[model samples]
Target chain A: MRRRSVVVVGAGPAGLAAADTALAAGADVTLVDSAERPGGQYHRMLPDAYGARAPEAVQHGYRSFERRVRRVLDHPRCSWWAGAEVWALERRDPGGAAPAAPAPSCPPPKVHVLAPAPGGGPRRRHVLEPDALVLATGAHDRVLPFPGWDLPGVCTAGAAQALAKGERVVVGDRVVVAGTGPFLLPVAVSLLEAGSTVVEVVEAGARARVARGWLGRPWELGAQAGKAGELLALTGVLARHRVPYRFGRAVVAARGDGRVEEVVTAAVRADWSVVPGTERAAAVDVVCVGHGFTPRLELPVAAGCALRPGPRGTSEVYVDVDDDQATSSPGVYACGEITGVAGAPAARTEGALAGWLAAGGAPRAGAVRALRRRRDQGRAFARRLAHAHPVGAAWPGWLRPDTVVCRCEETDYATVCAAAQDPTATEARAAKLATRAGLGPCQGRVCGPTIAELRHRHGTGQPPAGPTDPGSHHRPLAQPIRLGELARPPAPPAPDRPDLAHLPPEESGS
Target chain B: MSPRLVPARDDSVRRTDHPLTVTVDGEPVPGIAGQTLAGVLLAAGRTAWRTAGSGAPRGVFCGIGVCFDCLVTVNGERDVRACTRRAHDGDAVTTQSRRSGDPGDARAGERP
Candidate 1:
């Protein structure tokens, strides 16, 4: 009998748990991550990543995740791939585009992986045929524009956390962790434990208000508050470790000689503009700022899975997966942050449920479905957290004229702003001409929303949301593929001007 | 329990003695020795990295290299994520600007 295989993307908590479930159920499992290590960013393990006195919460989280990862790795039926990025997916079809398989039915899917081996020479591609596919692809931080934000020392709350947690190095003796949502809390706690004197936590939302709302939603309040309490207790750090918590305040400007030394912050009004007299300046060595996170949806988007507006402004795949963690796309399932940023426990539950359902085993009648409902409930809470902490419109106040917007292309706000102000340009052409925002390797996946928001403010008017039809934006090769791989044999010769010609050369050939 | 993840209790992590001069928004500044461009800028107390609307300040948030928040221009390259790239002696780092119109078309032919 042919061995059944399941591929789980992302080695974070959810993916690992799913792989474990599959392995226990006697299914062959493969777990993959872009990093050299498992645990994703949240459970990142550093080689001397953090100090010996690192917060117990972080230590505990990683300890638990590590044990689970090890358990999965030790399983005879389970295989693991670190530093492997899944670049594309191929199904046997004419368009080569994998049709969105209908929900809950596990299809034998093929995943294309790019691994630039440890020595770092050329990256190689490998394909895996899995009877079931699970996306635990996790998320990236939300980008907010602020003046001097283009300068050095300015980073995301997640980045700061990583340095403190994984590298065990503090950004500076004096640091500020500023952003919205629960994401910033761990960062603050980590920095404090790392011996960095947290100058302040410049939060855009009023914590009091969020706390009030969170309390009303007892479940959410408990989940987040518990996490926060754990981190604070483990770090043995106090609120003073974080400078006074300035709620509803946004960083307006961060200026220094060549680095960040001082930051200007202000309270944001309803119109998303800074309120006068609320502006204040704080002297600091590093400023870590972010709004929130957008789900990493490249695979799903490329898979042609229909998307609905996520809790945040991002898009998420629509699935009928009846609590069993299945996607409307048959044979494919999603859990964890990919299902929306519902945190770790929910992701683990969803993954286990999916594994159980995928393995010839039904979810003990209503039990499996009930677990799925619990996952959904957790997701709903996550959505609210995302909503409340959504990168508020007022974050733009932090951008300076010289601040960089697009790092991949080196495009900045001034150039992008000029293009948005161009009265005659169409939205499509304007984005291309100005700022070089969408022109980067990412193709504007990270900066698209921010660009659109900037354009609207600059009178570009609102461009319609939803996938751009008739536009060559969407095509088969979504992730970065090797140039040589694309030009391989049997892949057609050059078509000078094709509908999907706009795709990057690396992505186009595939 | 991985040894690589433990931080040395000593704060005396000696940085290489290499100085670089970079400008942030026309202000000539000195970068610290043996630090990433992002670190030098942060040590110097500059926080904003890029702006999206009305030229605001944005900075590094996810330092582990996942979030693309800490992006900036190093020399002539656009989108040179500040957090990952190391700063060198005499390196010129500048804050990015929000471009208008076709963002890529302006520098389309330029080498990355």
Candidate 2:
């Protein structure tokens, strides 16, 4: 019997684990990512081409993370296509089957990749048809737009950390790292090490809330107990650097003439609503803000997977998965953050399950049982974290009519509100069309969540900001390759695969 | 102008390469390899790239390719994302005006 072929999108912990486990189980695996490097956002390191001399000592966090990724990249049965952008997903259905599928029913979907350069050369697109598809596409920062967020000196905390790690650079001199979650700690430490005068780390979530939730849940943390060690170390680093750490406070607004010069830090209640009496101005050149993460579900949603309402209170979109990590779509599996934003350990376990299933393996029952228990614990902890730092919808209070919400099209709060309140506009997509909020170069990456929430508030009277479908509605060219790349002459169909009817047309020769 | 903030360059890690000059909004800016065009601009303390309808300037919001707030015209190619596009020596970078139309019909001119 021929070995099953698996295409894993993303090189983060989940995707890496999926590829490696599936390959180890005797399946051919191809790992794909947008960055030049393999590790997803969490374990991201500088590419080898950068030629870092002392690799381990340079980056913060565990080097073991990279070692885990190395296991995947080193596997003989796995091949990695770096710097590739997945623009579309084409499913070939069996004849007279689902109306969407153009061709006869083919079990797996064809992954379309735009390679800026395949072999240190010209850009080209390649098609990969797999026996099974594993989407480990990770998460990106959930931007809650505040006044002056679009200013030059302001960026997301994740972006700040990535810049320091990838380019060894910090944004500005006096930096204020503010947001919810402990993710800010390492980013602050790294910036401090990079000679930035960290004014303070502002956390919106009250410290009492975290202790109340996590103090008793010690057993669930398990192997991640080292998180406490890292936390203690980060606290020491901040204190030694003379950086003040403030809790129950958030950077409500950033101000500057041309770039960020100061941020208005205000104390907040448990739900993160700002307290009126505590507003104070702090002079800082760079304001790094992050609320939390939202999963990158474009590929999964594009593959026609079903989304169930995420954890009880959170407004997150979760790809419904069973014990085996299989999605509603046949032969399609999702793992890691795409399943839900659990930490790396949970992601790895989910990936293992997905890989095992995709590789056509009947895993040992005991091992499967153990993986499910770990996933449950990780998910539970994630829910508690989400509950603590939930995105307070009251942020619209910070916006004036002119404050820009959609940076791509320059749509402001007033415009989006007008569209949302328009009696004709019932759904979020209508607001999107009227205001052109999500229709720019970004296709709504900046304004999608905020717009959807505002629409939900005005149109439906729904509250929380957690569970909105931030994914772009089924557009074929989601990534937006240049038209010049697509206008090439149609290539001849391969003799072995002459029926290329299911795929979109592209020029065979330039 | 005030003196620029000094970065922590003394760490164990070495930069990918040396700095070279790239023109940002017609001014010569020093940029290094492995840094994006936006990184170079942000390093120089210039953030607002283009003035939009509201008259407030837009800079890097998402910092990744998605946001496109860090967009600038590089060598006459409009709608280029400065966050993902690396800076090269003598690369001419200019502010992207939101109202300006793209110079092409770029899809024309066939053979690569």
Candidate 3:
């Protein structure tokens, strides 16, 4: 029997699990990721050459991740392709050449990758045709815009953590970590461990509101105990380090000359509007701010998958998957944040299911039932977390008209507000056309959420967020690829090509 | 700033056995061999990469490269995202001009 071929788009926990499980299930597997190494964002491994950082900074089941990564890399049926940026997914039109060595009779979907170069120049694109693809492309920092958010020294909490983990450098002399959710705690601790002067941690949610969400369901309280202990422990560390933890507050604005010098924060009402007299200033060289996370929908949307409401009822779109972790599109399965912003555990469980199913492993009713139960538990916990730290709708009250909403396009509050208020610009796409808010190089990664909220919070704003809708990103090429390479004439098709074993090693970062 | 936060001498996390110098805007900047170009920039005190038309400086917003706010010039290549590219010894880098990737400069931040 011919073996099935599979490509997992991310190498993080979910992607790695998917690839590993598929390989174990007898399907040949290839793991492709933009990063130079496997371990998507959760287990993001630094380049091998960088040896100065501390592994303890990312102390989330490191031994397990190491073992999992090893399992994928060491498996005879599994291959790892790092530094591969998937640009687009092309459906296998009938009779067209498929990208991998699989059942040759039926062409599978082809994935286009723009391989990264060490010094950055013209690079070759590698094409992969797999019988199944699991997209575990993880989430990025969700930043709610403030007056000086576009300033030089203001960065996301994820960036601060990445620097310490990947480069052994903390981003600030005196950093003020601001945002909602438990994610901020580790970020602050990572900075402190890395020797940064963490002046404070400011949470947007009030203590009472956060605790309500933390308590969640009664049975889940046992599940929440570990996280609660972690959060409590982080607070103790902050006290020892003399870092103040402030609740019911948010960084309304960051001010600086060339780089950030100060963060002005204020207490907020339940709706998140600022309290009148609570404004205060903190002197800091860097401000690490984030609302939470938004699911990365580019890959799934590009693949023409069905979209569902994101975790916590946010307008963010995510790929909809079924019981076996299969996406609406056949042969495509989505795990991890791509399905929704559940943490590593949920993503891993989903990944195992996806890998097994994508490998054509027949579902045994008993095992399937057990796995489904576990998957549900993980998701329920995530929902609680998302609800606890909802991106306050009133957050925009902090923004003045001149504030920049889209950093890539330099679109400001005034311009976006104008577009939102305009009758012709009722939709996000129309507003984008009118003001270029979400049309920058990022294709709206930094500003899309804020733009969507602005179009609504302003009341006059229109164009409800929808899947494959104008308000949301629907671009076929999710990641950017050089025009010169893509525009170059397609190589003549090789006939009867199902052999990929002889491909050269990927172009590694030197 | 506290001896410029070099990668620790030894840690469980990966690092290079030796350090290398990458050039930033014609000036030699010392960095560990395996650090990212953005890491090199942050380690060297060159935090922000470009000044906007509004004169607001922008650096590593979404450090994982999705934001495109960290674009810079590598060697002669214009408008490359520093967050995504790794730094090699003697790699030439420069702060991208605010106007570089706008409609004006033909050499702008192009995705690869």
Candidate 4:
């Protein structure tokens, strides 16, 4: 029997696990990631040139991750494509016009990749049609707009942490890390470790609400003891650094001349409505803010995967998957934060299950049962997380009319509000067209959800559902491709070979 | 205040002393291997490399390439993300501006 071929679109924990287990199940695997390394944002490995003696000191579960990296990348059946971006996924027509024998009823989408050429030449594009596809593209920080967020020195907490972890570079000499989740703690620790003087870590969730959200259910957290311990250790580091961790407070505005010189912090109620007379100012070179995470949904949506509403009471949406980790679209599977913002452990378990199933592993395998239970626990934890650090419905109150909502288009709150409130612009699509908020370079990856929510809040009525919905989050071109690259024909698919040796010189490298 | 690199002795993450220079706007800026273009610029105390349509100075916002605010022209290639691209020796980096009348407008030549 021929070996099943699997293409995992992300080299993160979930994608790595998918490749590892698929290879173990005797399937040929091709693992691809945009970064130069195997680890996604979670395991963001420092460049080998750093030659760090204690890389593990800055990472969690580093030893296990290292083992997985070797096991998958070194496996003969696994082809690793680093610094490759999946520009598009071309869905095969479901209609049986051109009959291709042995193709699954729901054929996997054709993968279009832009792989970097060896030795810094122009990137070459390749196309692949695998038997099964696994998506683990992961998520990015979702920052709410504020008065001076577009200032030079303000950045997302994830960006600050990425600089510290991946490059040993701190974002600033003096910084304020403000957000609404446990993720804020680690960002502060990373900043401090990278030699930044973290003046304060401000969390928007009220102390009582946050505690109730976490302590409301004790038994459910038994599987997450490791997570709790990690948070506790992070808090200890903050205490040792003498960094003040303030609850019920948020950085509502940033002020500076050319760059951020000060941040205005204000106390907020449980719903994040600012309390009158509670505003305070602190001088800082940089301010890092993160509300939560927004999943990289372009690939999954491009693959035509169905999305279900995210955790209770949130407008977020995640890929809908079955018990076997199969997406609604056949031959497609989704894991990691794209399914939900469950942490790495859950993503890994989901990946293993998806990989095994995609490789045609037995449905009733003993390992499959264990993986499902862990995935369920992860989902439960995701629910608790959302309950605890919910983005306050009143967060829009933080926005001033002049605040820039869309960084790329430089669309401000007043313009967005005007578009939303205009009687003629009843549809979210109309508002987007009017303001050009999500049409900029980012393609709404940063402001889609926020704009959708703002429209639903300020508009005359709820925007009609479907792709036209501002939050639909659909884009035909998943990644940016230059006109020249797009005009060129994709490399022809190799015949019956899953090995990278068949690929062009640029992508043939392991 | 400028961002600085964490010293090897302080963090136990020893970086190779492989020195490299990338010219920025005709001036040579020094950096080490494994550091991104954004990292070098931040460490060199030069933030706000790009400007918005309103002429507001911008720098790294979302450093992982999701946000295009950190874009710079590299080696004459337009709109390369500074946060994700590793700086190479002799790489020519030019700061970009989106102000309507500025020649640096990324879309200026493409349209009317």
Best by TM-score: 4
State model 4's lDDT.
Answer: 0.85
- Lowest-lDDT window of 10 residues in candidate 3 chain B? B103-112
Ranking by TM-score: 4, 3, 2, 1
TM-score of each: 0.75, 0.88, 0.90, 0.95
Off by over 4 Å in 1: A48-58, A91-109, A116-121, A219-236, A240-242, A312-322, A365-370, A394-403, A410-430, A433-435, A456-463, A467-481, A484-510, B1-7, B10-62, B66-112
For candidate 2, the TM-score is 0.88
Ranking by lDDT: 4, 3, 2, 1
Report residue B66 deviation for candidate 2 (angstroms).
2.1
Which residue runs of candidate 4 sit more than 4 Å off their true CA positions?
A: A95-104, A461-472, A492-510
Cα lDDT tens digits, model 1, A152-239, are: 6676777777666544456666777776766776778777766777877777777666665445556554335554355446334545
Across A359-459, the per-residue lDDT of candidate 2 in tens digits comes to 98766667667777776776776676666566665667667788778876678888877776677765556667788888777777656767776676665
Docking class of 1: incorrect
Worst 10 residues of 2 chain A by lDDT: A489-498
10 residues in a row with least lDDT, candidate 1 chain A: A491-500
**iRMS per model in Å:** 9.4, 3.2, 3.1, 1.2
Model 2 lDDT per residue over B1-112, tens place: 2113234356566534566789976789887665677777777766667655445577776666767767788987777888777777898998855543433322234226
Which tens-of-lDDT digit does each residue in A80-104 have in candidate 4? 8889899899888464223333234
- Candidates sorted on DockQ, descending: 4, 3, 2, 1
lDDT of 2 at B44: 71
lDDT of 2: 0.72
lDDT of each: 0.62, 0.72, 0.76, 0.85
For TM-score, candidate 2 versus 4, the one ahead is 4
